[model samples]
Target: MLPLSPAPAWAVAGAARVRPGDAAWPSAARWQQLGEQVGGRLIRVQSPLVACRSEPASAACAQLFKAVKNPYFIGDDVALTQTLGWVDAWTSMPSAYAVAARHTSDVVAAVNFAREHRLRLVVKGGGHSYQGTSSAPDSLLVWTRAMNAITLHEAFVAEGCAGQAAPQRAVTVEAGAMWSQVYDAVTTQAGGYVQGGGCMTVGVAGLVQSGGFGSFSKRYGLASGSLLQAEVVTADGQVRIANACTNPELFWGLKGGGGGSLGVVIRLTLRVHELPEDFGAVNFNIKATSPAAFRRLIGRVLDFCSQALIDPHWGEQIRFRRDNTVQVSMVFQGLTRSEAVAVWQPLRDALAREPGDFVVDSSPLSIVSTSARDFWAPTLVKRVLGFIRRDERPGAPRTNVFWPGDQGQAGQVLHGFESAWLPAALLQPNRRDALGDALFAATRHWPVALHFNKGLAGAPAEAIAAARDTAMNPAVLDAFALAILGTQGQPGYPGVAGREPDVALARQQAQALGRAMAELRRLVPDAGAYVSESNYFQPDWQRAFWGANYPRLQAAKRRYDPDGLFFVHHGVGSEDWSADGFSPRT
Candidate 1:
């Protein structure tokens, strides 16, 4: 490599990253040297959809759109994320260059290069961030997609915890590995379970860092809580092992402290659990004939939930729609189909008695149970039912499958997305009516989906205890559910003629979702929002996302990455930098 260039005058005056056009930007020779250091894994990033700009009618353009709908294809590409962009917030912008890291050393090289050059740095593992943290323009990306590897242990202990901690069955997952792969290995093949994101294609590392949740979280806990150890490459380009008995504070910070803020995690070891015998679901919709009937229905539903479903057995969502419909899509574990039916019998009977006010779907309510191990087994699930969509691309892995419900999020252009954790106190008999009214009014502005599993209330004691130890907001321990209101359009990217995002519709939907969230916030005046799926323009994000834990997380950031080499939107220690994370706030 040639000798380094002189520092730009602007950089000498104040702190700012070296942009592509800056005088201090790395030379082509320098980039090539860094690439060679990583074994030629560096990629000159480019979106496949860029070709559509000049040749809209070409066959290649058609193929690109088709592939955009398949999340597996999106996950495999370093230039794309499951969410293409958020309206008026950000669009997926590929970095100037990316190191497709196949080993921890590659990540160290990329980090050292970024720091030495004073360049903006970004990290991507799952590339599924709705907040657009994984994609940034004019930056160097540490792409860990090629580093995926999974290893299981019958009895494992942290590196420095031989005497301090007991041996437990765990799974060691590489940064690039997805939840689908972990599920297949731990659940389907080994007859065990791993707490992870419900989205099968979501990267394991990102999920754990952002306080992951899943269908069985009520029984298990947040994925962050299950993390036993992690190997991270920090800003100093040093590979550090973090666990309970070693670098314990960094380990806590890595748990629910938000990804891309602390460091690039190369690998993780998560404690796994014994598999349950059965997994079951309940699905149905009820339509009310009048506004008064809808209010009554809401109250009755809340009452029923408080009476029966406030336990570790149930998870998933219950949606309240603008069309006066209540959609129930809930799952259960460790329960027989008959037992599950019996638990819901009273609610069914109450709705039936009010035939004049409410009408249930003609298709009878579905309450079915299946073997727990087959839940994530792609081949077995395909043989038993059409519950998943497989990656049909040539030579795709047989395990590359996602739930049909998650299809719309792949490469989606987001209009609006907002969520608030609803405290379990709202379920009290005295407060249930007010909570019902708030939910009803919120639906008038937009639909709201209450994801029960996202909150830790009503969970097992062990689950709650584990979650409390992480850096996540304490509000989650008492939150009964996370109320979410979001809207989106089809896969579209910016600067693509005739395929650009519909800004007008997006703004309108965003306002509606905001109003819907406002109504719910009236009841829980100080609700905390999940960091991964929160408002892009949240004013007091530090408090809303991490609550009292913000100061501690900031301290950890200063300890590990005091120079702020790692930057993501709203991440810890980000308040000292510019919005783009390229310049110091001063």
Candidate 2:
């Protein structure tokens, strides 16, 4: 690894600067001291390569291989997973140190220490950020996973809302709590539910900070919209409470501003909704013998979304693969099996009307009803099915039932991908067909999947307008304007993988997505893109991520973090710093 130059005198004394191979680099004794300072929770991470080198034929190596084989298993542990492995490698180019923050005070101490020592600091919540903002080269990482805690309030009020006439139901979640943990807590422990991400292992703080979207988004609004208050440790090491009536500007920024930009969010208080007794869902799969049939199927599904799925109560996801197959899973909050079919009659009729060759075979359309609590339980069946159906690994022989769980080398190198917003206008039958054709042609040579998440659509006009009240781009609201209201582009989900091991091929795919996104942006130049899911190297990033809100967010960054102490790739005010957390070369 190339060594970074010394810090400027104004930032820190010469003796205080720490960098890999420098005299100031923390030794084991220094690490112990730092741990003591943070209540003895600091941990020195071993390189995965080193961890897997325990006598290649030993049980230890076998167990390590097993643990790393499953992405989900690695992701569940806060220490193992970094959303994009390539970014992690880059971030660790310069030696990295971590502080497992267990309390607000620990974060405050970490911030103060890093600031005093002129060290780049990165806050990690779940470490699932698609852009890998949670990690940085030569930085002190404040890991919040140890601080997981949840508190439910029957009659909750915002920090400064005591005078309000109504007290809302709320849950206060620490930064480290995963979505699944929060889901179980609210549903079983508190008899309530808060609109959250679909992924079980996503961290609440990172999701909410980046303007969360999920199955209930159309009904309850984005997760950020439900935020009532937050406790944050700013760059100056001060812990402050932000709410509608206190530090309101900060509160507004925190709601939708991308994570790791403004401050380290220690805790969040979000409003909750009562859980319905029962909910309905439909799972459908259609296989087409040819690409023409696949296109026809896609057209039909888009037509259905444009017509029958506009109700906020309806939620669904549609996915299409290169093999000319489509799978659609839909859920309705209050509808029963028959009621759902009645509502879906138009789509059913459309499918029936399609030419006989359009579908080679299809599963019978059916609705499965279950109690809300039971319906939300995490199940391994879907994952197992996905594993069974996954395309053969490159260069591997195709097989109906092959498990390569323990066949790979100890350390694996992963790649990153880019996701772009799709304009809502393209949901129209003709436009949808055009968009589908464009995507199919653009990714024909790559193994990328095209997914249309319908559940995140149809957000109420008022809700869209409300997004403007926070730092979140109003374009996100417009993206939800599907079908009759004219289409708008929607932000892409960050978790989707669109990468290739070949750097050149990855760049080619990224460029394709970027070109597509650029065209979509031209349709609404004033709109913004989703920061979390966008290309890290996006041009005109401020406008693409925050739109008209960029100016205000920049001003807030300057005010709250004057020294530019809080920095991340693609974050607000980050342009002033280089990707390696250093001043850019002129």
Candidate 3:
């Protein structure tokens, strides 16, 4: 175990390191002092060392473990729960210290301390990062959970939009604010809404930075597209704003480039849409008695997606589980129930034409007509529908409502599960048959969940092409063409837990995921992946996530974060650093 080292001359007032096996290791006062130095609170959350202790449990160990056990269940302690995948064996490495940041100064102070100490630094927002990029072993964690603040403006003008158009309604959210918080403030306080992630507990900064998708994505655009300005603390400890008229290149990279790679985002301003008067949703549950029937149902849904549902006003999610159960959930804006049904008549007609002996349970397929305020009520979303896991019940129904509250025990349920994404094109008739056959054969030995949607399909070509100006993959905009013969994978949902206590078994499972991803890559070499929901072990992460944009993103990293102060697994310039903050390239 490493011993505590002396502080550097430039260390902050109370900055100190708590190393393993040190005499000061068990002192809560020492941890508290370090937190005070940065003008924030310190928390000793679960770490691998605590989990893998060889000695019999001591009183101190028990207290620490208990304190960290359910850190994410409380909505107010934003710093504690930002690492959703922190429990994974591969991602279980914990920082030596965590600083619950309360302001921009605290972040700047933390960054300086880390640079002086040569310690790895990780920034965390909502901690919903699928790849566990927000955490690492023996690093300094700057948790932004305490910095949540929301400011609403009726007619906000972005720096770039000042001269061209009238001011628009917008909201500026601090880094720690979650999707549910943004949803609540926008719908109620501002009388509007923004297209954001499906999970309310997800951090607004992380989601927008990684190219967010949501129920209103078809109508509005990705959450990233709504970003108007961002206040960031750079690696060099300088606070700056990135927007269309400010540090525009950095602004471009920050949008969809990936979070925790370029800088620590303290605040983000985004455009908001007025609450729609007419909104509708339809739920369908189709059960297949035989394999052929399941195949037919899937094919018809895919056909409906590719043909009849090209409009951005339509949004749907199709979930297929291992038990031959199928569910299709749809939501739309600016349409009444009858109008929505008229638009969806083709899908209903297609289902009528099916010759298979499957039951179409439209009993749950009622249309919802309500205002955005009623549609996105936090009380309704959080208490009733939030925190439901994909593995809870096979073929269970899902809604467009997002709960902006604590996930409680649900956060712990989905730790070690392996997930993958495939493009929407592969769901076509001929290609989908082969893929479904393959998945069915594979699932005979293990359970798998498949989610199908047009998350990035409706954006105009110009919008898709515009992603090239930033770090987001342009391939996302080309879903129609990309889906022709290959498949693109979707991001993982929150709380996909893993139960591999044995390290060896965990490694084996990770290897299997790698092989599976490799096979998927082989099928669709030209298609780019969604960075937010991918596995960290991508063989060629640059090409897999960024495609041709890797070089530009790398340049941005070199220009802004020259010393590599911020490094996330599989993020831009991360190839230069090893898991332990040592250079593998050297």
What TM-score would each prediction reach against the true structure?
0.97, 0.80, 0.78
RMSD of 1: 4.6
Over 4 Å off in model 3, which ranges?
1-37, 40-89, 159-166, 343-356, 379-454, 460-468, 480-523
Off by over 4 Å in 2: 1-18, 23-33, 50-62, 69-79, 87-95, 353-355, 360-366, 378-416, 427-457, 481-528, 584-586
Residue 490 local lDDT, model 1: 95
Instruction: Name the best candidate (by TM-score).
Output: 1
Ranking by TM-score: 1, 2, 3
lDDT of each: 0.89, 0.62, 0.62
Using TM-score as the yardstick, the better of models 1 and 3 is 1
Better candidate by TM-score, 2 or 3: 2
lDDT of 1: 0.89
- The global Cα lDDT (0 to 1) of model 2 is 0.62
Query: Which stretches of candidate 1 lie above 4 Å from their native place?
Result: 1-13, 362-365, 380-384
Q: Tell me the tens digit of each residue's lDDT in model 1 across 319-416.
A: 99999999999999989999999998888887888899999864543787888998877665454566767888899887788888998999899998
Residue range 179-285, candidate 2, lDDT tens digits: 76788789755678797875555678998988886665666677888888999999889998998888887888887788988899999999888788776666766
The per-residue C-alpha lDDT of model 1 at residue 359 equals 90
Error of 1 at 566 (Å): 0.4
